[model samples]
Target: MGYSPSIYKFVEGSDTPVPLDMDVVRAVLSPYDIGDPNLTVMDDGRLQCWVRAADGSEAEIFVDEVGILVERPHSGPGVFAIVAELASRLGAAVLDPSSGVFFCSREAHACLPVDMRKDVIVIEMTGEGVRAALIG
Candidate 1:
């Protein structure tokens, strides 16, 4: 079987859908030291970034009103850790639809609610920004 893409959905607590602020996105990603940053606005309106991964691989990451998209994401454990860290920084949650795994920024895993049967996620855009939740 071909690889299934991993998706991260972002939402805000207040229910307002706001376009992701590129400045905040940049600040959140800066610590990763992604080399050769090339940012562009795609035809569909999403902001795309092409960067050099730590393992010397080329990676593409995109952001928009819906969420952040990672193309051909790394499957390493450190990648997940970085995801968790990013979730924490964004005050968001990361849900693995394929695996039904949920990572939260504000609380411990034990306290978060998850529905294993659901494969879709709904991101709530709050006044402060976004918070992720599982749906479908």
Candidate 2:
């Protein structure tokens, strides 16, 4: 089976639930400075693009309300590395080494309330494969 992307709150030592916000997410991701050639902002604000690996394989990357999702069916281990690279670029800390659960940097996390940071939202790409959301 292909890897299904899952979103989780990265806040450390806090149990408060906070809903993902696109603007806050944007701020956290600003450091990546994702350029036009590598990334594109859709009309609805979601980001769609491909992240190329050193081996020349590319993984599909989408960022929305549900969180950042990466899918690279045939790319193998490089796909996870791409996810880790993206998270690092966003200044987010990887909470789970296995799943690559990342939390926005402490500075960015302050923008949202503790309560809003609850469940991890796993976005399901539909059959049409057109639906996507963004954090900011």
Candidate 3:
């Protein structure tokens, strides 16, 4: 499960983004540890999972022809689904989105413009989970 204390920070409210790699990102993920690891694409048009974990959440990863554009967890049942949907629309990945908190990869941050990222609030992750209402 993606649970790293250093990965997140709690400010006035909302989750702040920190620099993290795909491997470290994969390691902290809760779903992957269980066996339901999120899928990553290979060059040959085949499928290779990054980290496997367990969860009833079902979904698949899709990629555009080029290989740079990735669409993963196409659909699923959970908070992650909302994230996937949003990312799909934005052509990005769900780096972090728990309740009121919304942390994204540095790439994703750049994908979104400065104005948009500025609007996002920062909240600290808590044991109970992020409080979604803070954003509103």
Candidate 4:
């Protein structure tokens, strides 16, 4: 019923590795049959995507060159899985901008440069739900 904070592709603030583009998005989501995803020409000019997580919950992601702009995160832990997958594949860490919480797939966390000992919240997806730790 309510909205979650906007998520972002981050590698320490605005220093993301590469600018995200529609072409790459299309490639990544191709397996899902999302089909030629394009940006909505609204004020934000974001590419909207509807993704269904393995658990059957769906989420709407609005992305641009800067990464996720607005998220209509429907609900459930599945949305986090969606974000983790994107982060892992994109080679970037996910950030909940408002909370300053960083997220990365467990598979990729060890390789991240987020100063894992800096005492920030980092979350990883687990089969049961999620795992959180105070690390940057």
lDDT of 2 by residue, 96-131 (tens): 234444344344354334554353223222211111
Output the number of the lDDT-best candidate. Answer: 4
Which scores higher on TM-score, 1 or 2? 1
Q: Mark the 10 consecutive residues where model 4 has the least summed lDDT.
A: 127-136
Q: What's the candidate order when arranged by decreasing lDDT?
A: 4, 1, 2, 3
Model 3: lDDT to the true structure: 0.33
- Regions of model 1 farther than 4 Å from truth: 1-19, 30-38, 108-136
Judge candidate 4 against the unseen true structure and give its global Cα lDDT, from 0 to 1. 0.51
lDDT of 3 by residue, 1-136 (tens): 3221112212223234322234433333434433345545468754334322143443233333312122233222343433333233333323233333344444445444454566543332221122132122
Q: How do the residues 1-136 of candidate 4 rate in per-residue lDDT, one tens digit apiece?
A: 2444443444443334447655666665444434344433447665666766666666566777766642555455665555555555665555555466655554445444556525334455431232132111
> What residue runs in model 4 are displaced by over 4 Å at the alpha carbon?
5-17, 21-23, 30-45, 105-136
- What are the models' TM-scores? 0.54, 0.45, 0.29, 0.58
What are the per-model C-alpha RMSD values against the true structure? 8.3, 10.4, 10.9, 5.1
Give all candidates' CA lDDT scores: 0.46, 0.44, 0.33, 0.51
For model 2, what is the error of residue 77's alpha carbon versus the real structure, in angstroms, after optimal superposition?
A: 3.5
Candidate 1 matches the true fold with a TM-score of 0.54
The stretch of ten residues in a row with the least summed lDDT in candidate 3 is 2-11
Candidate 2 local accuracy as lDDT? 0.44
- Evaluate model 4: give its TM-score: 0.58
TM-score for predicted model 3 compared with the true structure: 0.29
